[model samples]
Target: MLQATLRFAQTAYASTKRLFSNLFFEDALGVETNRPVALKDLGLAHSDRVDYDPSPWLALRRILPRNEVGPDDVFADFGCGKGRVLVQAAGYPFRRLIGIELSPELHAVAGANLDRSLPPARRADVELVNKDVLDYAIPDDITVAYFYNPFAGAIFANVIDRLAASVRSRPRALRIIYVNPVEEAAVLAAGAKLTREVRGLRPGKNWSLRKSIRMYTLAPPPC
Candidate 1:
């Protein structure tokens, strides 16, 4: 009980502190870019929440601690809003990092943030594409994919289908890492095989929202 309380306090503190770094993030609501990505656009559907939380992308914090991923891996973040996940994930050892974000404005903000955070000498292989996740091809080289419940179960299902196809084309080298994965897990568990269940990804209890983050491997179907 004490530990959970302490953890929540610390997490809240950290999040608040980071907010001080950028006021737009700290004080603003959603609805950015030319169109779409709007928290209210009926088209964005389930993406309206715009959680924008980066805890799930801390590779060493909760993901790789239980999974077999490494620094040289390739990562793709679907619905990469503001590119925070990609930028945070880059701190790891990935050889190539990519993000697909539909909102041109958010993509530009993410690009700017990445440029500000990462030196030009170190950003040779990281890139973010301004494209819809459904239209973008799932790169065969992406070993790990991330989702933060960015879409409805239906949209997530489509992404899972594409991810599964990519794995079938390559077999055992692919992994799906989902944060705040209640809805996303439905799509993954139905399509992809479970590799491991990670519990420490979300902040400890006594906090406002409770979330589950899981890791799964999309292996080939039975022969």
Candidate 2:
């Protein structure tokens, strides 16, 4: 099913590109010509077809409040694509950072991007793994975890349950930061009660639209 969805998305993206070539070129104002590549050539699986907006990473910085984590803090990004969040997180004072990516191609891309940001000694502190988030086991060492609509509500629910169980087994205050929170209801349904929500994000230079982001720290469900 995941492969099939990726294939479908590949075809759709190609079709959309062809249909919008003028738009793409026009948006760039005739700077460069555009061409379509085969999806397999890009090494993305069907599940990798989903292009999630990376807004949540930026919004997350505001919601996590920076003060919540210390220099020894461990950070994790679920479904990290090309390592945007992982690379950006490296700029902060966190002692360790990890990004989980299901796409091998994306993992390599993110690794390369992260390599560019490293200060030699600190480069070893960041790692990106190519594995499904569902099958992936998060480390007990993580003090901060982030998500950006990596999957549907069902999977989000499972991840939420897993996070709660992880903390219960380990007993440390772990914070979950979600951006572009489309599966928020599912997170709640999984018994991961939200402790806070941050709204409104400044638009990037390319995008004229302003956006709102919500963050939720875990809390025990109301009995």
lDDT of 1 by residue, 119-187 (tens): 686566787898777788778778888877676556677778777777788765677877666665565
- List, residue by residue over 1-66, the lDDT tens digit for candidate 2: 866866686677556645564464323332121232233565554543344334433455677666
Q: Write down the RMSD of all candidates, one decimal each.
A: 6.3, 9.5
- State residue 163's C-alpha deviation in candidate 1, in Å: 0.6
Which pairs of residues clash in candidate 2, taking residues 3 or more apart in a chain or in different chains? Answer: 6-46
Task: State, as a TM-score between 0 and 1, how close model 1 is to the true structure.
Answer: 0.71
- Provide the overall lDDT of each model, using Cα atoms, as 2-decimal numbers: 0.65, 0.65
Question: Alpha carbon lDDT of residue 107, candidate 2?
Answer: 71
Model 2 residue 49 lDDT? 38
Please identify model 1 stretches exceeding 4 Å from their true place: 1-38, 41-60, 70-72, 188-191, 200-209, 221-223
Ten-residue stretch with the least lDDT total in model 1: 26-35
